[model samples]
Target chain A: MKANEVPQDKSSLDSINQKELCYATDESGNYITTKSSGWTPKTIALNNAIEDIKERAEEAKQRVLNNETSPIEYYMELNRMDVTILAGYVGIWPFRVKRHFNPKRFKKLSDKLLQKYADAFNISLKQLKQGDLNED
Target chain B: MKIDFKHHQSAHCENGVVSNLMKHNGLNISEPMIFGIGSGLIYCYIPFLKVNHGPAVTYRVMPGLIFKRFAKRIGVTFKREKFKSVAKAKQRLDENLKNNNPVGLQVGIYHLLYLPDHYRFHFNAHNIVVYGKEGNNYLVSDPVIETVATLDEKQMEKARFAKGPFAPNGQIYYPISFPKESDIPYKEAIVKGIKQTCRDMLAPIPIVGVKGIRMVAKLIKKWPKKKGIKVANHYLGQIVRMQEEIGTGGGGFRYIFAAFLQESSAILNNEKLMELSKEMTVIGDLWRDFALEASRLYKNRKATTGSYDKVSEMLFELADKEEVFFKTLKKAIK
Candidate 1:
C-alpha cells in the first residue's frame, strides 16, 4: 500500500519468475501484475496526481478568462501559466525544436493562439511591435 | 623637423629645378641607396624594406620603386681576389657557385690540394683559377675545369708555356637577380581585391562603434545553418573588436583571416588545419571551439576539436581563458 512497507532488501524476496517483476493473475478477479513489470507504482501514482493538479489549474485558468477585469493583468497571468495545463492534449512540449518535432504543426497552433489573444486584447499587431521595440 | 630632401632623392633632374621644388617644400635630397634613379619617375616610397634571405631578393614595400630601377642593379659580389694554394681556390669557387649571385675577386689563403708545401696562385673572376701541382710538377686550369693536366717536359722546362691560357684573369661569378616588372601586378591585384571585398562586407555597417551582442546574434540568425553561425558570431565579435583595437590602419585583413580560419578549420585536413591554426591564435581556436560546442549541443554530434581537444584547449587557454586574445594580438602587432 505504501513504498516504505515494501521489502527493504529485495534480495531475500523470492522472484515469482526469473524476473524480479512479472505479470500474474492475483486472488482478486481482475487483471493484475507486479507494478515494476510495465511501470513502477510510484510513476503511476505521480502521473495521477499530476493530472489532478493540471485539471484544477485549467479550471482556474478558465475562471480567470471568464471574469477578467483588466486585459493587461489577464495576459500577465496567462503568461504565468505553464505548458502542462494543456499538455495532455498536445502530448508533447510546444516551442521545442526537437529532431522528431513537426515545426509546421507547432507554428500553426502557435499562430492560432496568438490570433485569439490579439483579437481578445483589442491590441493591433503594429502597436504590439512598437511596444516591444520601445520597451524600457 | 625639416624634411631632408637630399636623403630622399638619389638623383637630380637635368634642369636642377627639382632642387628648387625641394627647397620650396623644405626638403633635402641625398643618399644614393635611398633615392637612386628616382628622378622623373613617380616613385612610391617603400614604407618598409623586407629583404628575403631565401632568394636573396629584397621586397620593397613600394611596388613602383621595385619595378623602376632597384630590381636590375641589386646584386651580390665578392670583395677581393686572393689565392695561396690550389685547394683554396677550388673551395672559394665552390662557395661562389653556391651563391645566388657571385661575382668579383676576393683574396684569401689558399691550400694546395695536390702539393702540400708549395703555394699556388688563385684568381676569382667569372671563374676560379689555380696554378700549381697536378703530379710531380705544376699545372693550371680554368676554375670551371673538371680536370687538370700536369705540365709535360717541354711545358715544365719552358717559362713561356707555363703561363696557361685557361687560368682565370679576374672574372668568375653567378648573378642573383629578379626579372624587372614594369608594374607590380600582384600587389595591385591584392590591394584591389581587399578594397572590393571590404566595400561589399563592411559598407553596410558604417559606425566606428561597438558591435553589440544582440545585433551580432540577429546577424548570426540570418546566416545559413550550414555556415556554422555560432563560429561566425564569435569571429564577428573579434572582427569588430580588432577594428576597435587596431583602428583602420590595419584594415579588415585581420578579420578576413579570422573568418577564413574559423570556417576552414571545421572541414580542412590536419595539415591545412595546422597551417591555418598558426595564423589564427585566439579568434580561430575560440570560434572553432564555439562551433564544436554548438554542433555537439544542437546537432547531437561529438566535439569538433576531435581527439586533440585537450591539446587544442591547452594551447588556446592562455589568452582565450581571459577572453583577451584579440587584445593581446593587437598589442603584439602594435
Candidate 2:
C-alpha cells in the first residue's frame, strides 16, 4: 500500500481517539510509518465483531429476564467474557463457571465466590447480587 | 527512577520494544531491520486451536520468538524472568526501576484501563515497556500508541497476572549487554534470516506457511455451508482482525518484510533483492484486496450469494503469489 493510499475512514478507533500506525511505501518505494485514522475493511470487521458481542449480550439479557438463566450470564456477555474467558479471569474451571449460569445454582453461591465473579467482571458484589443490568 | 528511554513508535509491539531498547543501549536499529533479522514474518492457520470460538489464524511467528531470535543473531544477551507471585513481580519491577533500567513486560490487553474500550480483549500476549514509576502510576511506552501511556498499580497488577492461554505471568525482560556494533555480522544474519523465512514459507507441511494459506482458503469455502451465516461471518471477521490488528503492522507484516528486503538489498549490495522488494509490495496489496472483500462479506455490504467463495478464491491467489514470491526470494538470496 502506498503511504498516500492509506485509508482514513472513520470508525470506532477514531471515536476512541486512537489512530493506528501503518507501514506503507512512499512515492519512492521507501517504507514509512504513517498514522491512519482507520481503513474501511478494518473498520467494518471491528464494528461487526462489536455488534456480535452486543447481540450475544442482548440474548443473554433476555434469558435473564425470563429466569431461564442468571444475571451472571448477562453480565458475562456484557463484559465480553465467554464462559471460558470469564472462568479464566475468575480462576475457576469452565464446567463450574457454566454451573453458575443456572439461576438456582447462582442464588446459592457464597459471598466469597460472588466477589470473585464481581471482581472478574470489574463490578461490585452488590451489583452482582442485585441482578440488575441497570438500563432496564 | 527512570532511564533515559527515548520512545520511538513502530507499527508492532515486539519490534517497537526491541528497537526502542536497542536505541537506548547505544545501538540504533530500525524496526523493519529488527523484524527482518528476527525472521518474524510467518503465516499459520491452526484449525484445531480456537480463539473466540473461531479457528486461530496468526500472521506472525509466536510471541517473543522474534526478539529472542533477533538478539541471538546479533550476539546480544538479555535477562528474562516470569514471576508466579504478583507481589514478587511488583517488587522486581520496582527494583529494576530503582536501578535505572527500563524493562519490557508482557501483559494482557484486557484490564489495561488506559486503552480505549474497543481495543481491550481477553488476549494475553500484549507487550509494553515500563520505563519509570511516579507515585502509584507506572509510565508505560506501549509501542502501538501514539504517545506514552500510564497504568496504575491496581490495573498493572491485573494486566501482568492476567490468566489465559499465553498468560504473561508477570514476565519482564531487558537486554543485559550489547555486542560492539563492528563485531555484529549484518550480512550473515540477513542471509540466515531470509533463508529461514524461505524454508518456512516453502515447507511441505499442509497447515503451515504458504500451504496454510491454501488450507484456510479451502476452509473458507466450506464455512458458510457448514457453520451457517452468523458463525461463518464471525470466523471471517476473526481472520481480518488477526491480520490488521495492532501487532501485524499492516497487511500481516508484509509491508515490514518488504521494507526489510529493500534495506537488505542495500547492505548486501544485491540488485535482485531490490527488484524482489517491489514484488513483495504488490503481494502486500493482494493481501489487502483479500481483506477488503472478506470484511465486506462479513459486514453484509453489497455482498452477493456465494461471496465466501469469492474471498476463498482471493486466498488461493495469495497462496500462489506467496509461493512464487518465496521461491524467487530463496534463489535471489542463495
Candidate 3:
C-alpha cells in the first residue's frame, strides 16, 4: 500500500510514545529512515488483540457473576489461557481442569489443588478463591 | 553500571539486537543488512504446530539463527550459553555488565514489563540486550521499543524462565572478539546472502519458501470446506498476524529485504540490484494487500464480502510473483 494510503488511526498512533525509527520507501521509491508515528499495520493488529482480550475478560466476568462457571475459569480467560495451558501450569489433566470449571467441582477442590492454582497464577489461595480480578 | 551502548529501534527483534550488538562492538551495519546476510527471511506453515490455537505460520527463521549465521559469515567469534538456574544466569549477566559488555538475551514477551499490555503474548523468541544493572532493575535495550527501558529483577527472571514452546532457558550471548570493519567481505557476503535467499524462495519443498506460500494458499482454499468459516477465518488471521504483527518489517520481511538490497546495491556499485530492490518493494506491497484482505475476512465473521477462495487466490498470485522475483534475483546476483 502507498504511504498516503496507510492507516491513520490517530488514537492508535498516539498510543506509541517512544517514536521508534523505521525504514520505508518514499513515494519516489527512495529509501528513507524516519521516526514511526505508529501508523503501521502491526499497530492495528496489536489494537485488535487487546480489544479481543478485553472482550474475553468481560465475558468471563459475566460468566462468573451468573455462577455458570467457577472463578478459576474466569481467571483463566482473563489470563488469555485455555484449558490446555491452565492445566499445564497447574499440573493437572486438561479433562480434570474442564471438570473444575463447574462451580460445584471447583468448590470441592482440595487445598493442594487450590494452592497449585494460586501458585500458577502467582496469587494467594485466598485471592484465588475470592476471584479477585485486580492486576497485581 | 551502565555500558555505553546505543540502542536503535528495529522492525524485528533478532535483527535489531544483532545490528545493535555489532555496532556496539564498533562494526556499523544496518538491521536489514544484518537480516539479509543472516538469511533471515522465510515462509513456513505447519498444520500440527499451533500458536494461539491456530496453525503456525512463521515469516522468519527461528530465534538466534540470525546472530549465529551473521557472525559466522563475518568471522566474528561469539559466546552463547543457556543456564539451568536463573540465579546463575543473573550472576553471569551481571558479570558481563560489570565488565562493560552488553549481553544479548532471549526472553519471553509475556513477562517483559516494558511492552504495552496489548502487545504482550506468550512468544518466547523475543531478543533484547541487558547492558547494566541498578539496585533492582536491569537496564534493557529492547530493539523494538523507542528508548532503552528497565526491567525489575523479578520480572527479568520471570521472562527468562518463562515456560512454553521455545522457552528462553536464560539464554545469553555476546561477542567474544570483533573483526575490523575492513575485514568484512561485504560484496561476497551480499552475493551469498542473496543466493541463499533465492534458494530458500525457490526450493522444491512444498511446505517451505515460495512453494510453502502456494501450499498455504491451497490450504486456505480447503479451510472453509473442511474446518468451517470460523475456523478458517481463525487460521487466516493467524497467517496475517505472522506476516504483519510479528516483527516482519511490515510484509513478511519483504520490505526489510528490499532495504537490504538497496544498501547492497550501493555497497557493490550494482545498478541491477537497485532495480531489483524496487521490485522487492512492490512485492512487499502485494504482500500487504494480501494481509489487508485476509484481515478483512477475519473481521467479517459473517463471510459477507470476503471468501476463503478469494484470499487463497491472492496468495497464489503472490507466490507466483515471488517465484519469478527470486529466479530473476538469482541470475542478476550471479
Best by DockQ: 2
Better of 1 and 3 by TM-score: 3
For each candidate, give its TM-score against the true structure. Answer: 0.16, 0.96, 0.89
CAPRI-style docking class of model 1 based on DockQ: incorrect
Question: What local lDDT does model 2 show for residue B111?
Answer: 75
Candidate 1 per-residue lDDT over residues B254-280, each given as its tens digit: 222333333333423223433332444
Model 2 clash count equals 0
Off by over 4 Å in 3: A1-8, A11-13, A40-44, A51-73, A82-116, A130-136, B246-252
B1-334 per-residue lDDT for model 3 (tens digits): 8888898888788999988998898888888899999998888777677776678888888789878888888888989999988789989998999899999999989888666666667788999999889899899999887788899999999888776668788999999987777888888888888888899878888888899999999998888878888678767776776676634533748878988998999998889899999998888888888877777777767883247788889999989999899999899887
lDDT of 2 at B171: 98
RMSD of 3: 3.0
Winning model by lDDT: 2
Q: What is the lDDT of residue A108 in candidate 3?
A: 90
Candidate achieving higher TM-score, 2 or 3: 2
Interface RMSD of 1: 44.0
Candidate 1 chain B — worst ten consecutive residues by lDDT sum? B51-60
Cα lDDT for residue A121, candidate 1: 32
